[model samples]
Target: MKFDYQWVKDPECFEINREKAHSDHSYYASSQEMLMDESSFKHSLNGVWKFHYAKNYKETIRDFEQKDYDCKDWDNIKVPGHIQMQGYDKPMYVNQMYPWSGREGIKPGEIPEHFNPVGSYVKYFSVPEKMKDQKLYICFHGVETAFALWLNGEFVGYSEDSFTPSTFFLSPYLEEGENKLAVQVFKYSSGSWLEDQDFWRFSGIFRDVELYSIPSTHIKDLFVKTVMEEPFDEANIEIELKVKGKIEHCVIQSELLDPDGTEVLKHEFKITEKNPLLSIPVESPLLWSAEYPHLYTLILTVLHKGEVKEIIYQRVGFRKFEMKDGLMCTNGERIVFNGVNRHEFSAKSGRAITKEEILEDILIIKQNNMNAVRTSHYPNNSYFYKLCDEYGLYVIDETNLETHGTWTDFYDKDIILPDDKPEWEANLIDRANSMFQRDKNHPSVVIWSCGNESYGGKDIFMMSEFFRERDDTRLVHYEGIAWDRRYPNTSDMESQMYTPADEVEKFIQEHPEKPFILCEYAHAMGNSNGAMHKYTDLVKKYPQYQGGFIWDFADQAIYTLDRYNNEFYAYGGDFGERPSDYDFCGNGIVFADRQLTPKMQEVKYNYQSIDTTITDENITITNHYLFTNLDEFVTTIMILRNGVEIESEEMILNVMPHDSITIKNPFTPLDEQNEYCVQVVYTTMEDTLYSDSGHIVAQEEYIYPYQPVQTLSNKKIRIADDFANGVTRSTPKTVGITDKSVA
Candidate 1:
């Protein structure tokens, strides 16, 4: 049973021969057809398990499943969690350096033998009577690095690479009564080179794990590719199916149901082989857009021997995306991206976020009038892309290939270029391919990013080329080329991270050949980013200056109770570790506990896609609805007294398409002495977005007092009072605010 594995260029060792029963390629069901025969099973293998920790690989037991070995002294640990967070190892926060910093100098594909920690996990369970004679398999949704598995002293399998699902057949190794399962997870493997993402490095089985039985006849894989022609008025649909077991006669039926549950198109085909391709024509299909987001259900039924055995359903949208006249267009309209960068992180769960958290993120983005998102640094979970497709949000699916630790040093010392590392080339391509294959079918994904923070090179160029060759449905993105100009064509657009406004303007002014985007800017660190209005103002002046993604959405935090027994989500350095940056990880628009930060007030104000201008002193407003119509929403007019509302009115105004209108009668402010600020709000007449009742989509506010300015001479400052905690300085022209310093 020994298999030879290459260090870096081994694609053969990655394939598995044993087939899964009743499992579709992209979808799997453990229901009546797959596991109902084993009804006595009560629990799943997803929660807590017995755990043993080792500091390094050398300290771990290589043969933990030896017949005489005993794991009675092992401690308890939760599955689907990180070993570092469970008190087994210290939480390290170095951006680019490996965890084995002072100890090792290992190159690519070489594991650190000295300080690579290993985790040994064990689970004890008994098979119910119904599952006695059924064929069973174990599936791991995600696992860090590499690991070997054993069941009751018999070796089952070994696997590496943490992003994809891997299943192993376990029927041959199961016992009749009590069963013992063992898993050994390593901190680093040769596969770790491909997983150099920017987030904190951790090791463990971080996703779901389940075991189920499968039926004899099943569909192994299904491929769906739909192309819309003539501006989504007509569609050409193609489906390819791969099946397992015997099929004397096969029949496939497909139906397209519209949003109102009406059958739009239906077709049936006959098949006699294992794999077959079926193509059908759909007339006058409903197109999907960020504005409308009309979706159709694709129901597929596979029949064998005149009996329905498999039914797979996929929700699809008809849309065409292309680049025209130097602009990216979707469904024949120029696509303007009002987007933000999102890291798949949770305050209480780290990267293991639940469905509710993900849905909440989508609602927030949509409510703020944002239509796009960039999966910054790496690819998110599969369910995230599915939700984006359903919710009508555009996606920039990024691959998991970031060597920031290696390239961060190059930035400081002007070290020519370090991206041509021969050992890391295959890893980069493999990572890009993995992300592309897994996310290609999603209608929401519009761009394929090679990676982030890694300086551009031939390795990344290959990745860009691979994306162009594999699929023409989306464009490629790589922001690192702004650092290395040698490969200017590596990315489809001129994207940079954290560039100043003047620099961005100059870059666009100089090379107007491609569009410009700020991938990461206005670093929202602490109570910072007071200058967001400056960059957004530039968007109005330049059309090529498309919008960009905010650096992040939320801070990564963990749930913990304080000394007063108050439960608060904690972040880096909260565990009392040495050499840590405290509170630096708390730089999210939302607080560590998922509570909205005050910074979101600025975000909601600036991220509004529409702008309203009121001419004359009476404030007759004009609405710039990017997606919705003014008549569809209720407008609220408010006059504020120095940031406080003193006079307000709710009015109904019907605005025509792209036209300006004057209000019939304007209400005058009651308070004239105070600084009277005028504000206008536009909300849905009926709830259309992901909110209940009504939600505000656009707002405009004008600060009052019009501060009359007076020229002041540049004079020296005089110290009025100086103290240990507070200091006061005054200029000759006017007294300034006091500055406080903490000891």
Candidate 2:
């Protein structure tokens, strides 16, 4: 097989070590640091960087770490961006087949070497006085495949697994003056075999790179888990602390506070030299749910001889999740997830999305009445999950593993089925375990998915079993397993994608063994899913059939400048590229620029718990609105006498977004009733984030005086045509027009 020689070079060994590379006065403390504003945090390392482009890793310079490496002759590029989109390399995309499959016939556990490029990045940075004394570690939020670090030409360390944070402590090598940080990012590493996600193949330091300091005595890691029982009248709390310091004995304390800042419970735990686990129980806890996401504060203090050494605060929720009677329940109530699949992305920045973009996404989701999100394809940034916890959304956190390309052939190679390999099982199970260990403590993550689109196999089955063994509180999800009956136990629910309405009903009827959920249905790609009502109608008809999440929420368009020198949104091929599946990534309810698309109008009404459709002759309302009392919304009845509103009044009606209410108003025909048309409108009394400030959403009109009632009696006239033989057969059919004809 032809090789991409650069693909085999490991880049994780040369990453920067902040402490030895520069001088800082910041106190040496815990590894974790606050990322909030004004916290003396530094993220400016990403702004300026001297860059060198290499055709492949084999041609890259090894002396990039040397301060006098004459990088002035090379081009510069931004650190937190993709090399492909920034004019360094070309972007290549292939589905179910590796990008180099045609050129290099490499199999599992191997990568092409001829074309694997390496990005050699160098940056000059200095430590501020306040942070000069502290132990510092350079952190990378994300890097594709692998990266290596070097400080002042001295090798720091190596790291792989791109989607998660990898921080290397740098304290031994110290310099009091100007410092040079160098890094070698390989396009592929040994870990690349596991990161075969179905996405455009590109590489670079696509996430934030920063230097952080830790105090001498600090909290290393915190685990907070809470349980509420007795109908939320009592609570049990468990807190585990990992500390790093010279302190002998310590004191830890915690307090449970309400949203109003009132303390519900407070306790202090005396830590002896022998014991460190602090477990406390609370009484009368306020449960956290999607409707009311109540949270509590857990504060831990490390002390030495009664003097406080350091203080750490964590915000957590007290709730319980279960799958009771084939229904996923949270806080003892069934949850109907209104979710969207989100690929951690940006049009301009690739996957290195900023904090502002993250905040904007959360706000958009909330405003659209979407309560849950599925991290499609892979795990996202750690900070993204923290935002989901704060903003109140359930998460089906997925692992960073997708082998879509390994299983399928583009030009007719042998089809690699899921159960074909023995080694594939172990590799997939490791991915699942790693993701669960990193994100297990998060409350927003209610379900653990076993990755996506790899299809089913014994190895995939083992991954599902691993989840149940490690964590039973949440159910496991793997949609591809639905295609293979051998792994019927793969997902807890009967999940399918894009199943038509009739098929769904048949499946529900045939299999009452499990609840039905469209893990992905209603192919909302381009102008599709026009008849969405058919699927929603099934949800109302079958109690065993739960709701499904939409295909996506936003188009993956990136911001760019057009030929006219005007800033515009661009899709796959706008960057002058080949081998691009242009606009296939633009499937979203909202446009890539964050503007609401017309499809949202249909989504909003269909997902609304309350349904009301008004007509001049009658009003039909179906209340699917959950939780809210119908009486909360004042139903305003407005009658337009003729094109112009002749009368309007607010009448109290027992109506809700999720409940059915029918009301008919007797109308008095005008003397010249033909001159006037009748119009009826129903709307909410108050402005909602979703609705346009109490604007009428459902209205109907009819021109009428009063048509005379015409009832046609059914008169049967049988007609039969037969060739006279030994047998004569006839079936009578009749057609008649009725008074209430739909035509």
Candidate 3:
């Protein structure tokens, strides 16, 4: 039953019988289960699995999915891991070019024949008792490249688009006893050309694998959006519900819980339509922002004839992100993004970043005053967005598509992928749809990025339109439009990468029709964000100059043993791979091991929302936050002499946002000639999700109480222009008392 996998070479044939992409919201049977953040409905298949690695497609084991085949004796590999990281294949790193670019001479949308690795994986499990009579489904949260699935010797489905979740129904192939689930993952496919991200290329089942059963009438997909009217504080909560199975005659009990755990709104309604939109209006609702992450939990319970079927605890946020008066604005005021481009990576696991790492990343971002994050080249794990929502950080959710290597030359349009090519339209559209569907519900996701470095084309323009047509709450972003001006409307803003500060200012001055942002800037290579202040300074000069993202947040280096058995963080070309771009990927403000670099301090100071200045007579505070006031933080004043604090006291200054206030000096200046310093530090008065109380957010220092002029003598002897040329050396002939020793 060998069917030629010719689809691997065809860009159009990416998926067959794969389930449609859906919301990341999960469901539970009872409210208790929802509170516990656990679902009895989902059964995790993430563990050791029987595995075999093949160097190429032709070397793959035949009939490996057969019911009579024995795979228990095969080598074991972790389910949620990359084959390369598990000692099966070497991890490959190529920035813009494909891994086999110069080696294979393959065309775009074509895979290598002799070197693509294939992983054969088998896991055996029996259906849980709770899921006995339900519609069983197998979910692959994420798999690299392309893969085919089988159950009990029957072909189930095939899928691609490596970063998004792919689910397939297994009811037809289910048996009474133990079932054999086999998956064959190909290292390269037509999709490989689209997923040419700068990070290390690793292939396998690298995300969670789950088997789950849904309620008879389940909310298959859920979208919660906000509509703000006058007064701005008040908004309407809009929910789009897509239900599966029979939903008629069922009743929905929905309630909105505020951040303080109070029920603000509750309604009971009967299911009446196939896909329903429920809207609830409220006055003066709590808004969500990076400064204040106010999440209102919405609990929806489905009941049919007084029998509860499912309950969902979905976090909802009330905020508006739109273009207001030629500038990107959130809520009502023009906004600035203090952001970093984050690649989902680690020195240990590559893209398989851990939960702790995600939390660490978010906390570091928040504590360092970074309000936004650009998920550099692709969509990260779902948990990353969830934490971003909870901890309050703006996100630019990007699709898994990059054709950088395809554009061989600036004028070679024929070689570039999706360069108005009809055959490649569906693939880009699919990637966009996949990203939007999975991350649409997150409040942190303020923008949808088409992709990175794919260049501009009609296909990408159509993708922007697709995102706009599907979701109006967020804007579409594409940096490639800066490369090609054929489609000016592909991006909502004048987005660019690595654009110089002077050029950015010039562009905004000349073309203020749209807001401007450097999608990737201040290339933090080798821990150098040189002249970062030059870019951030433009935000004050022009409203159109919103902000920019640093090239990266964390360095992408892997730790491996050297010849001497000592461990070191290895970048490209470390594994003896050829044609590599060595150490070019190690460009992060933070080290590959997640330690803060010296560059992070510069970032914190440059991106800090509060501007503080201190002098001998007064201290001035300028609140740069669009939504927060200065009074929310605790400000401390310190008087120091010769680096030692002589006086310290706390003071309150309720300065409004976008406004500045100068407080008079209460302490008298010392008359004695000494090095006196005045320091003002702003810290959090209350504990935040990212930092504890008393954590300094911003500070300023000024030293004074010294003479302004330095005198070499009572009367300054001004030197003539030609004094040095005419004057004989004053003491050159004298060699002190002794010739060998100085007097």
Candidate 4:
């Protein structure tokens, strides 16, 4: 293969010579002893890389991928970083408008010729002695727009999808020592048309890049499907393994370990073919849900001639997610998604988020009573799904395709991709398949979203159908159908973005055939989310009205230094860029620096699963949880007079799931001179990973009306004083006596 610049402008040539597909992301170790430890077969290429920035293709250096072409004066730029953030170019944030709007008159498949930025990166490394004999591969976690790769002056591959991992076989191109790896990342491509998400435009290798080795008898792919029977008691674990390289005389050993590390089921098989399918049955499996995320480990050990060659670990959950009775349910219980759309962003880095940052975000979500998260308009890093699975947050995994700019810029009815464009169908389906293949093993993902704001068309409908055809374990979601009702079946649910609560209610009441959810609602722009409670209240009023995800979780601002040397967060248009969305990117409950805002209080209150109603005579508690009971929470009742607490009592609640209980108020109200109020609070009874014990989950207050005290006139006060002081000389002191009454 040879590198060519023209491929950057072609939509059909998005990927070139990419490596074969493998199982969903996992760390591989050669031996069972090092299974839990870091793999020695992998090497990180995430440090500094020699870089040269060019304003256009013509200005870029020619034959830069050649092994001896560099003159050793190139600038140093950090890998896994955006060139714009490193002073090479400028970051531009535009929503529903192309960055080259006025400068160029290009269409969907063509890119700008004069102003397109090109980043040429070079890294020199040697093959590790341990991995010299093994089959080696290079993986790019993410790249913006499009890019081409060359190793030791030989063309490797080209890829355009920016969110998913792009792997290439490097063993064939490697040298004995001092091998050179070159990459040319383009700022624009045909992929950029579909990537027109409402986010800041950045280009580079903004994610991790590493090299890994594969063993001889390795498991190339593994698909484990947990299917629950009708009674929801027993589950069938179907395992399909795809082996690469040498598989003769190899034995596959599988084990299912419960959460407590107890092995329940074990199976053994001989590898006679490249792909093998096996099944195991379990009785009364512990199903997973947002409330109770019970995970079971599926360990696969490959034995070659009575010796363990490789061990693969996968976490599995047996649960059913389906649409039954016009509602979305999980594990046979109706589910409500108290979710928020999350963008992979940070203050210091644009989209180069760290694991610590992801953990913090998930923890904040859990503490704030959020049960689900939508990966906004694109798929996030592979590790994010694992965190969501472990932390018990339902996920709505979305594909990396959005063409909001098509309709907004053209102002025409026929300006979109994957709608009726046959050329874009393969790209659209490839994105969906990539997301599904990478994130299929996670039980937290309850829905697969086609894309965002791309508008409905045959391509999108096909994408939705592709998801359903591939995986029946999860439901399909696409909000573009709201734009074009011609393809109403593009989504399983009636999904809408930013629609008002009343409108949603009316639609659900009128239709009632499918569940309604606000895919993006309560726009959390600065001081936004007002009246969000109405939507949450609708969840209680109608069964078809499921909850929705908020507009976003955090502001998409980059941290930068101003002229005064003071550091602050910068949003759109701050970097001397035109056609930007400006402060519109600051729509988040949390600030860019990971600080909580006042809006989170309202979100917590509205999204809390427990509903408590307090009155002077009694307190009623409703367990809104689908599976768990209220007993795990400590309920406290407080008596307050004139907004001040007068008495308090605490007790453990025993309300079952989806049930309510009324308890008589235990506080004896004091006959005070002010109105009374009863405050009921629900708190965690035990300490958990995300929060401490006694953390308040929900609270409600009810006020008791009281009669106002009457006021006495000054004349009545004077008359009483005269009687008490025995001042009979009141000279019939005018009943309405003034200060001169003594005269």
Best by lDDT: 3
lDDT of every model, 2 decimals:
0.69, 0.66, 0.87, 0.86
Q: Please give the lDDT score at residue 49 for candidate 4.
A: 94
Give the per-residue lDDT of model 2 (tens digit) for 1-743.
11223334322222223221111112222225322323453435777588887877669986777766656556788878888778887666444556666676666555567877789888777776767888777777678867777776677776666775666775554477877788777776656655666456678898888886665655565556676654777777776555566546666656666766787777887665332666677777766655556677665556666765555656667778887777777887667777778877776777778888887888777666677888876878777777787777888888766666655553222344335466456546655765676676677888888877766767777888898997756888888766667778888878788888899999899997787877777656787657777877877788667778788877877777777889987776666555466777777887877778888777755555555565555666565544455555555555453345566656656765455767775454554422345554445567643344455444444565543334444454333443344344343433332222222
Give the residue spans of candidate 1 off by over 4 A.
3-44, 66-73, 125-136, 152-154, 171-179, 194-196, 212-217, 272-275, 410-423, 485-489, 561-571, 574-582, 617-626, 640-665, 669-672, 703-743
Judge candidate 3 at residue 697 and give its lDDT.
88
lDDT of 2 at 225: 68
TM-score of each: 0.84, 0.81, 0.94, 0.94
lDDT for each residue of candidate 4 in 1-743, tens digit (9 for 90 to 100): 68877888877787899875555645455444345557766899999999999998899998989998873578999989998989988999998899999889998888888888999999989988878899999999899988999998999999988998889999889988899999999999988999999999999999999999878888877778898857778889988778887778889888889988899989898988889888989988988887788999888888878777677878998889999887899888889999999999978888988999999999999999999999988999988898888889999999999998888778776676657888899888888887888788899998999999998789999999999998888999998888898888889999998887888888887899889889889998877777999999999999988889998999999899999999988988898899888999999999998899899999999998888776667778898988888889888888877666768888888889989999897765555435678888989999987889999888888877665344444343335667878654323223321223211
Pairs that collide in candidate 1 are 96-405, 347-557
Candidate 2 matches the true fold with a TM-score of 0.81
Worst 10 residues of 1 by lDDT: 734-743
Q: Across residues 1-743, which tens digit of lDDT does each residue of candidate 1 receive?
A: 53232322232233333233222233223235222323232226888788888987668776666534677577988888778777887555444554554567765445677667889998877765655666687777667766777788787777766765567888888877778889888777766655555455678887777775544455565556677655466788776667666666777677888977799888988777888888878888777777767778777776777776556566777777776777677776656676778887765656666788788888877776778898977777778888888888989888776666555533443332226656556656766766776676677888899887777778788889999997776888899888887788789888888888888888888888887888887666788768887788777777678778776777766776789999987666677654344556656777655677777778777777556765336455554444456777788988765566666788777776345666642444444344556788887778665876468877876655443223455665545455554654545354322222200
Candidate 3: C-alpha RMSD to true structure equals 5.7
Candidate 2 clash figure, as a count: 49
* Of 1 and 3, the candidate ranking higher by TM-score: 3
> Distance from true position, residue 216, model 3, in Å?
1.2
